[model samples]
Target: MATYAIGDLQGCYAELQSLLERICFDPTQDKLWLVGDLVNRGPGSLEVLRFVRSLGDSAITVLGNHDLHLLAVAAGLAKLHRGDTLDQLLNAPDCDELLHWLRQQRLLHAEENYVLVHAGLLPSWTVEQARGLAHEVESALRSDDYAEFFAQMYGNAPIAWSSELSGYQRLRVITNACTRMRICTPQGEMEFKFKGEVSKIPAGYLPWFEVPDRASRDATIVVGHWSALGLKVTPNLIALDTGCLWGGPMTAIRLDDRRLFQVGCNTPVAKDW
Candidate 1:
C-alpha cells in the first residue's frame, strides 16, 4: 500500500481527480495524506469536499488556515473574504455533514519518521510537543462550545510560543503556527505578512522550516500553504503546495519512495490575494 501526500486542494476538484488518475490511486490499498485547505479560492469546492469526505479512513487531512476560516464563517463568527469561493460549499445539502467532518480533522499528523501539517511547527516544538499541541486544538475544535474557540481564534498576537501560555492564547499560538505560519524570527515568532518567493526572504526572518536548531528537525516534515516556495524537497523537508489556485499545478508525493505526481490547474488563474 502506498501513502501519498497531497498539497492544498483549494477547491480545485477537477485537478485533484486528474492527479489521482495520473497516479492511478487505489483507495482500497493506497492511503491519502492531505495537507488541508481543501476548500476555497477556486470553483468546485463543494465537489472537492464531498469527494475527500467520501474517502473516509483512506484519507487523512490536517486543518489549514482556509479550512479554519470556513468553520468560523459557518458559525457566523467570521465573514467571507473577498477571494473566498466557499459559498457553493456553504449552501451544499451536505454542508453540515461535510463541515462536521472537516472540524474533526486534526491539526497535525505523525507516523513513522514524518509529521504532516498544513503549515510548519514552531522551532521549539519537538515532534512529541507538536502532537500534544495539535491535540489541544483538535479538542477545542471538536468540543460543543467550539464557537467560542472560533471567536477567539482569529488574532495573530502572542505570535511567540511559550509552554506556559494557557487558554485561547495558547491555542491560538498553536493554531497560527500550524496553519498560517510561513516565516519567523529565530526566536520562533511568526511573521504573517510575507508570502512571496524565497528570493524575497524578509530581513531578520527565516522560513519556518529553516530556523536553525529546530526541535522537529529529526523528523521529515511534509507541508503545504506556501505556494510561492514551490515544490521544494530536501532531505528533511518536503513542500507540496505548488500554487494550484494561482494558475499553477496541484502536487502529490508518494511518501515511501519520494515519487512526485502533479496535475496542472483546470480552473482559471487567480492571482494571490
Candidate 2:
C-alpha cells in the first residue's frame, strides 16, 4: 500500500477526484495524507467534506485555518469573511456532524520521519514538542467550552512562543503556528501578513523551515498554507499549496517515490481578495 500527501483542497472537489484517479488511489490499500484547508474559497465544500469524511481510516487530515474559521462561524464566535464560500457547508444537513469531525482532527500529525501540518511549526519546537502542543489546542477544540476557545481564537498578539504563556494565549500561539504561519524571525517570532513569494519576504524574516537550527528540521515537514511558495520538495520539507483555488493545479506526491501527480482546475475561484 502506498501513501500520498496532497496539497490544500480549498473545496476543489473535482480536482481532488481527478488527482485521486490519476494516482489510481485504492481506498482499501492506499492511504491519503491531506494537508488540510479542506473547505472554503472554491466550490464543492459540502461534497468535499462528505467525501473525505466517508473515507474514514483511509485518510488523515490536519486542521487548517479555514477549517477552524468555519467552526468559529458555526459556533457564532466569528463571522464569515467576504470571500468565504462556506454557506452551503454551514447549511448542509450534516453540518453538525461534519464540524464535530473537523474539530476532532489533529493540528499536527507525525508518523515515522514525516510531520503533516496545515502550516509550519515554530523553530523552537521539536516534533515531539509540537505534537504535545498540538494536543493542547485539539483538546480545547474538543472541550465542553469550545465556543469559549473560538471566541478567543482570533488575533496576532504575543507573536512569539513562550513557556510562560497561559490560557487561551498559549492555545492561540499553538493554533497560529500550526495553522496560519508562513514566515518568522530566526528567534521564532511569526509574521502573519506577508504571504508573497520567497524573494519578497520582509527583511529579517525567512520561511519557517529555513530558520537555522530549527528543532524540527530533522523530520520531513509536509505543509500547505503558503500557496505563493508553491510546490517545494526537499530532503526535510515538502511545501505543496499549489493554489488550486486560484487557478492552479491540485498537487500530490507519493511518499514512497516522491512522484508528483496533478490535476488541472476547471472552475477556478476569482482571486478578488
Candidate 3:
C-alpha cells in the first residue's frame, strides 16, 4: 500500500481522477492525503467532495482556507464571495453531512516524518503545540457551541500567536495560521494581505517557512494554499498547490520515494469564464 499527497483539488475533479489513476490508487490499500481546498473555484466541487468522502479510512485531509470559507458561508457566518463556485455544495442533499464531516477533520495530520497542514505553521509552534491548538478549534466546531465559534471566526485581529490567547481570539489565530498564512513579520505576526510571489514579500514580512529556527523544520510539512508559491519540494517542505484550477498541472508526491507526478490541466482562463 502506497501513500500519496495530492495538491488542492479546488473542485478539479477531472484532474484529481487522472492524477489518482496515474498513480494506480487503490482505496482499499493505499492512503490518499489531500492538502485541502477540496472544493471551490474549479469546475466540479461537489464531485470532488463526494469522491473523497467516500474514500473512508483510505483518505486524510486538512482544511484549507477555501474549505473553511465554505463552512463559514454555509453556517451563515460569512457571505458567498465573488467568483466562488460553492453553490452546488451549499445546496446539495448531503450538504449537512459533508459540512459536519469537514468540521471534524483535523487541521494537522502527522505521520512518522511528515506533518500535513493546509497552509504553513507559525515558526514558533512546535508540531505538538500546533496539533493541540488545532484541537481547540476542532473541539469548538465539533461541539454544539460551533455557531458561536463560527460567529467569531472572521477578521485579522490578534494577528499573532501567544500562549495567553484564549476564547474565540485563540481559535481565530489557530485557524488563520493553518489555513491563510503566507507571509509574516519577523516578530511572528501574520501578514494576511500580501498575496504575491516570494520576491515581492513586503517590508517587515517573510514567508512563514523562511523564518529561522522554525520548529517544524525538523520534519517535512506537506502544505498547499499558496498557489502563487507553486510546487516546491525541498528536504523539509513540500509546497504542492500547483494552480491546477488556474490552468496549471495537478500535482502528487509519492511518499515512499519522494518522487513527483503531475497531469496538465487546461482549465479555462478567467477571460473564458
Candidate 4:
C-alpha cells in the first residue's frame, strides 16, 4: 500500500481530484495523509470536507489554522474574515457531523518515522513530547467542555513552549506551534507578524525547521503551511503548501519514494492566507 502526503487543500477539490487521478491513487490499497487547511478560501470547501471525511481510515488529516478557525466560527467564538469561504461548510446538512469529525483530528500525526503537522514544531519539543502535548489539546477539543478550549485558542500569548506550563497557557503554546507558527527564535519564542517570503523573514526569527538543534529534527517532519517557502524536500523536512489557493499548483508526494504529483490550481488569491 502506498501513502501520499498532500499539501493544503484550501477548498480546491477539483485540483485534489486531478492530482489523485494523476497519481492513480487507489483508495482501496493506497492511503492519503493531508497536511490540513482542508477547507476555506477556495470555492469547494464543502466538497473537500465531505470527500475527505468519507475516506474513513484510508485518509488522515491534521488540523490547520484555517480548519481551527472554521470550528471557532461555527461555535460563534470567532467571526469570518473578509475572504473567508467557509459558509457552505458551516451550513451543510452534515455540518455538525463534519465539524465533529474535524475537531477529533489530531494536531500531529506520526507514523512510519514521519511526523505530520499542519505547520511546524518548536525547537524545544521532541517528537514524543510534541505528540503528548498535541494529545493535551486533542483531549480538550474532544471533551464536553471543548468550547472552553476554543474560547482561549485564538491568542498568540504564551508564545513560547515550556514543559512547566499548565492550563490554557500550555494549550495555547501547543496550538500555536502546531498550527500557526512559521518563524520563531532559536529558544522557541514565536514571531507571528511576518508571513511573507523566506527572503524577507525579518531578523532574529529563523524558520521553525531551521531552528538550531530542533529536538524533533531527530525524525522527519511533513508540514503544510508557509506557502511562501513553497515545496521543500530535505532528508528530514517536507514543506508542502505551494500556495494552491492562490492559483498555484496543488502538490502531493508519495511518502515511500518521494515521488511528486501536482496539478495546476486556478483559484484566485485571497489575501495572504
Instruction: Identify the runs in model 2 with alpha carbons over 4 angstroms from their true place.
Output: none
Tens-digit per-residue lDDT, 1-273, candidate 4:
999999999999999999999999998999999998998889999999899989999999999999999999998899999889988888889999999999999999998689999999999888998899999999999999998898998788998877788999999899988999999988889988788898898888889999878898879899998988899999999999998888789999999999998899865665653
Tens digits of per-residue lDDT for model 2, 64-102: 999999999999999989999999999989999999999
Off by over 4 Å in 3: 269-273
For candidate 3, lDDT tens digit of each residue in 160-270?
A: 999998889999999999999999886789988877799998888888998999888898999999988999999899999988988889999998899899999957447
RMSD of 4: 1.1
**All models: lDDT?**
0.93, 0.95, 0.90, 0.91
- The runs of at least 3 residues in candidate 1 whose Cα sits more than 4 Å from the true structure, single-residue gaps closed, are none
TM-score between candidate 3 and the true structure? 0.97
Q: What's the CA error at residue 75 for candidate 2, in Å?
A: 0.3
Top lDDT: which candidate number?
A: 2
The true-versus-predicted C-alpha distance at residue 176 of model 1, in Å, is 0.2
Give per-residue CA lDDT, model 1, range 139-228, as digits (tens).
999999999999999999999999889999999999999999999999998989888888898789989888999999989999999998
- Model 2 global lDDT (CA atoms, 0 to 1): 0.95
Between which residue pairs do clashes occur in model 3?
Answer: none
Better of 1 and 2 by lDDT: 2
Clash list (residue pairs), candidate 4: none
Best by TM-score: 2
